[model samples]
Target chain A: AQSVTQPDIHITVSEGASLELRCNYSYGATPYLFWYVQSPGQGLQLLLKYFSGDTLVQGIKGFEAEFKRSQSSFNLRKPSVHWSDAAEYFCAVVFNQAGTALIFGKGTTLSVSS
Target chain B: DARVTQTPRHKVTEMGQEVTMRCQPILGHNTVFWYRQTMMQGLELLAYFRNRAPLDDSGMPKDRFSAEMPDATLATLKIQPSEPRDSAVYFCASGPGRTNGETQYFGPGTRLLVL
Candidate 1:
């Protein structure tokens, strides 16, 4: 079975500051990775995902993640975070095979200060 | 801009009462998934369906939980004799591909509270 672990439970950043959220996964082989964000009273929104190809994948809202097979990690990053970026973030892993369900991390709450 | 839709954004009921939640997946999407979110658990997959057929439901409690997709667009999850421990935010998501890399669009979760 696959599982995900997010070391940070919460992170606080000032506006315009860079941010990085760490995520690690345990899977037999290379797995699909994704980052999602959920604002208050809203559904989760996909930040980005990694299947194959370039190690660094860019996503919506200026978010990006690097897939490090050696580290078993897919860490989300943003050079400059906006106040609206405050939300709960989740990291998930899915099997390479089709139609597999995702195993999600516990989630990290992001608090942005102006 | 098609998106998944869920009914009864908020549901409150007494213990032992029956509660049902509904979902409408995006058009042309073949997969639908149900997830539960709480402060303690974060998010947990409860069930999923493909082609209007249940594909996995191992996360759901057999005794009190049931999930069904009666048609292409409609999916429902029901809990009988609810308990306070069951209180959480229930989310419905759908996607176009069966592959692992497919993006799933989520609907605003339904908040269920059992008193």
Candidate 2:
């Protein structure tokens, strides 16, 4: 079945450490990729999205993601992680077409240590 | 900024009880979606509507789950005789349209607990 997969279920990083959350998808068509962050008891907020544009996309909160067509991956990165960045991160792909309902992966939880 | 809103932030109920959750999509949005989040299943799309019309609901249980867009502002999900397995956070999302960079805006989910 075509699906989105987040390789790491949980990741721990020291404050100020760099962060990378991997997202891989199995799809045949050109995909629109997205990254979203959700804090505890809060709704999901869009981090960044990759449409038909420059492969590297920047989003709010100093987050960025790269869309690598060769790997079918859209990995999220942050140069310096902060304590507030500890949250559940989900990678999504528009199931069909450019903009439509998204298929989300099992999220990766980020734990920040002091 | 405008945001999607959901009603009854939290609810605790017994098994076999009826449960209803409501959502108010952002104004001028033409698409609405309902999703359920569980540890076992992750986030699953339950149903969606386009311009008050049901587009797809294959993810929802036909026997017990029902979703409707009563108006432009209101969308509802009702489960009759809900079970403990139905306990999860239900989220509502909306977009300006189906295509053309219309990304979804999610609401703070309604947390439902069925004993």
**Number of the top DockQ candidate:** 1
B1-115 per-residue lDDT for model 2 (tens digits): 9999999999999999999999999999999999999999999999999999998899999999999999999999999999999999999999988475468999999999999
Which stretches in model 1 have alpha-carbon errors above 4 Å? none
Total residue pair clashes for candidate 2: 0
lDDT per residue as tens, model 2, A1-114:
679999999999999999999999998876788899999999899999998879999999999999998999999999999999999999998867744778999999999999
Model 2 clash pairs?
A: none
True contacts kept of each: 0.64, 0.62
Error of 1 at A47 (Å): 0.7
* DockQ values of all predictions: 0.72, 0.67
Ten residues in sequence with the least summed lDDT for candidate 1 chain B: B95-104
Deviation in Å, model 2, residue B75 alpha carbon = 0.2
Docking class of 1: medium
How many steric clashes between backbone atoms does each model show?
A: 0, 0
